[model samples]
Target: MFIQNALPQKPNLWKYIIGLIVVVFFWRGLGSIPLIAAMFTKASDLGSIDMTPAGLADLLGANLFLSVMLSSFVLGLIGLFLYVKFVHKQSIRSLTTSREKIDWGRIFFSFFVTILFIGGFLYAGVMMEPDSYQWNFNKEAFIILAAIVLLMLPLQTSFEEYFFRGYLLQGLGVATNSRFWSLVITSSLFGLMHIFNPEIQKIGYAVLTVYIGLGFLMGIMTLMDEGLELALGFHAANNMTIALMVTTDWSALQTDALYVSSAEPDLGGMLLFLGGMFVVLLGIFALRYRWKNWGNKLFGKALVLEEETTA
Candidate 1:
């Protein structure tokens, strides 16, 4: 049904291809402006600075780097809306959900569930190892970080959902005519997008398995829920809450958060943690959503008239 939203219009396959390129170009080109400006503001000798996560954070200051980094994603989000509206000639609602109204409940529920599950333990760890966390809180600076996060993370995560889960997933599904391949392609691409992130570089490429795997789970969630609500909310809550709650030397965006992890990456431990959490998360989501017929939903044909199929 979600994929069928692209069908009524019978969009040319090239439209999806060209649109993706245009959007990404604008996203990268515009997003790079801040980083470029930082070369001037953050450097006396730009050539000497390493471009890694900690390196950038050190040069730009944690708060300013995060603010600038997230600022680029804002333009990327706008690019998606513009391309979807004019190029695809699709309404934002159509891009978002099949319901007459977008389901805020699903979004909020996913948000709460994911935060409680992930953040709860992260906070517990900070408490348990009081030495691992140094309170980096500053009243004036934290107020600024909170404001930047509130404004930017939603835009960043929402754009990711709209692009990966909503746009590419549906477009590829229609083109390939198989839900499995669509999921595979989009999920892999989602992982690849983060190929340049500091986490992957820090933890080694094995971490991509986690990224790709999470992409698959999120894609499955999108298909199962018949919308982007759960996926969008979960992503937003994960990034926003994490940025507010902690800063780690290895994280993508190092911010002035309340706690910072001093632990080095233990690949086995990291993988185990991700794999374990993923299983529990899927189990919980499955029960909450009452998901059924995995064989049909994931591997079956794309529905023709979503209403007939869903009904």
Candidate 2:
């Protein structure tokens, strides 16, 4: 039923694939414009600015750098919009959910739950190692950072959620005719997308394990719930809380956060916290929604090739 939502749209397989490629190419190319300008400004040479996250942060200034990157996701959103509107001949609503209307309740519930969940992690870490963090708050800068985050963070997180859990999840399910493969493929891609983040450079590739794990959890939420609401809410909350609460030289989002962590990441603690939080969040959703059909929802082959061919 999830992938079948695409049936009425009559999508062309090749067009969907090619269109995404074109959109991403253009969108990413445009995001590079500011970085290009920064390079020239910094050393009077086009290639002077190193392409690392920290390098860009140094050259562009933290706030301007983040604004530029977040704006690129807005472009990605537009590309996805163009594809759904013209190429797929479908409404964004269908891409979002199987329900008659968007589920704001699920979104809000997941959002608040994630805030508390991650808030706990931060508190525990601080309690355990008080000296590891520095209060980085500058009230004027924080107000400015919060303003930017409130406005642009949603666009950044939503762009990723819609593209991954919504658009690509649905697209792959329909393309492969198998929801299980769809979930795995999209989640892997989601993880790999962050492989180039500054965290990888700081903490090494082990952090990718955490990224991929989070991907699977979000993918599970989307597949089992038959909507992007939970995934979108949880992701938005995750990023928003981090952007507001903390930052590090090694983190992907090196913003003017309230607290800055000076210690290297505890890989084991990171995994444990992520895994534990994921299970707890899943439990909350399971009980509240009374989710059923675990064997089928998470792993069942929903779109058989022959069945789709016949249909």
* Candidate 1, superposed: residue stretches over 4 Å from native: 305-311
Over the stretch 26-51, how does candidate 1's per-residue lDDT look in tens digits?
67888889887986786788788888
User: What local lDDT score does residue 214 receive in model 2, on the 0 to 100 scale?
Assistant: 89
Best by TM-score: 2
Residue ranges of candidate 2 with Cα displaced over 4 Å: 38-43, 304-311
Quote the positional error of residue 20 for candidate 2 in Å.
2.2
For every model shown, what is its TM-score relative to the native structure? 0.92, 0.93
The lDDT of each candidate is 0.83, 0.83
Which residue pairs collide in model 1, if any? none
Q: Write the per-residue lDDT of candidate 2 for residues 1-311, one digit (tens) a residue.
A: 55667778766778777867956865687756765665566667645556777777788777877888787888888888887888888888888888888999999999999999998788777788889989888998788889998898888888888888888888788787778899889889989999888887777888888988889999899988999899988998999899888888877787888898898878898899888977899999999999999888878775645665588
Superposition TM-score, candidate 1 onto the true structure: 0.92
